[model samples]
Target: MKRSEFIGEFDLDAVLTELSVDLDIRVTRRMLAGACIGSNPEDAYLSARELRESLEWIHEGENEGKVKLTTILSTACDDFQRCLYYCVAGKGVVTMLDDLVWLEKLLEARGRIAGHIYRNKLPVKPLVNPYVAAEPDGPLGRFDPSFAIGASWSHDPGPDYDSDDRGPGPKLKG
Candidate 1:
């Protein structure tokens, strides 16, 4: 599946709820909001730190059939990275570098979670069009023409067309 399709199909809140149920980890929107919009730098740092530690704990446990947990942690890591962007936007780059360092640690933790999933051979359902065959080299190999909007057809000039800088005109059939 295309990356855009995968992103559009994945539901972060649903995955978070599934992870919370499977791993018994309480991940709340409030915690995420605190990480994203803390009152001060220290508070933001603390929130990110706590979230990262929680991810580490989750990674250490057996997550055989918890593919949703992996997705949740990956989403959390992306949220933390976005928070760093906000930090850089508000504060100078020099100060935000410290946060960048912390973000790297969080990324590493996320990688470990991914590694656990890969190692356990977890079943990740692919988001695909049921009408299309599931073969990689089949009809799905080509981009769906329906996705093309406002595509210019000027490049395709039919035979017997005069090219005197007029370009291709719309063709009509009787």
Candidate 2:
């Protein structure tokens, strides 16, 4: 099929089917928002709108055999990496090195969560970011803000750096 024709059929459902292992509307939305590109503002807006509608459809329990959000996201990350590999191998457009770094971090975080879940077998509650507040009447109605946000996890001597002390050199810029 022609690229234009293929793209035309690549709707949200198609994307979800491609990326989803187990998915939910709200979580699916949150994932997409994190993955949204800012290079084209209009495209971002349209993408969000489309994603919202698509997720709503799933939220209403329209899609059959849907899986868990984490699984879906894990599969998505894998699929994204595969696509990147294909792009490079096929001499197609490749994502920026910074984007690759970010993706690598995402993959690592996902792997950690998957490993933790596999080891624990406990219910892993989704920590909805305060910035992207979940609707009270939405699918994820019960808000679970148990996780920390914007906190530095590094051991760097923050704000206490002494010029003469030479503390592990300058810390990497976030």
Candidate 3:
């Protein structure tokens, strides 16, 4: 199945939510960010290792009655493992590098599938700046420019202003 189709078929958000609620563990964006690793062989190895370790940790917690795992959670974990497997082989070497032509293809596929699962599944909200007002819609908002004023200075030069003045007041002595 296509990567998007595969992602759509599984309710990853529900699985993660179920795990978090049952385990009473907070799953923040930072935790799920680990899934984005694997740019290189070593990174991919580490990412897979981390996922495996996480699964083992969860299993241990389940066994100790500290956490609970439903079938869906288990399946989701297994799917993640499979996704990691495609990026690097058992010995931590990329599988398709021998044929340089196909390496890019493999990497692209791996990234697309894993990225969709990791990024699209997470419950992360975009951070908003409270001090700034959101731009309105339409061309006016799009064309508007923002400016920062350091200090206010009067262009009129008050009552002492002269239209043909060569300088503003007298130059300060050093």
Per-residue lDDT over 39-77 for candidate 2, one digit per residue giving the tens place of the 0 to 100 score = 122333332333333323333444421222222222422
Candidate 2 off by > 4 Å: 1-82, 86-95, 123-174
Colliding residue pairs in candidate 2: 22-67, 22-68, 23-67
- In candidate 1, position 72 carries an lDDT of 29
Prediction-by-prediction clash tally:
0, 3, 0
Error of 1 at 172 (Å): 70
- Quantify all predictions' global Cα lDDT against the true fold: 0.34, 0.30, 0.31
Model 1 spans > 4 angstroms off: 1-84, 123-174
* Residues forming the 10-long window of minimal summed lDDT in candidate 2: 88-97
TM-score of each: 0.25, 0.23, 0.18
Error of 1 at 5 (Å): 31
Q: Candidate 3 on 1-174: residue-level lDDT in tens?
A: 656554434332333234323322212211222333323323333444544443344324333221221221234222433343233222111111221112233334544555665676743232222222223222221111122211211121222221223466652210
Question: Lowest summed lDDT over 10 consecutive residues: which window, candidate 1?
Answer: 145-154
A best-first ranking of the candidates according to their lDDT comes to 1, 3, 2
Supply the TM-score for candidate 2: 0.23
Q: Which has the better TM-score: candidate 1, or candidate 3?
A: 1
lDDT of 1 by residue, 58-130 (tens): 3344333133323323342224433333433322222223334444454445445445645765543332221
Model 1, residue pairs in steric clash: none
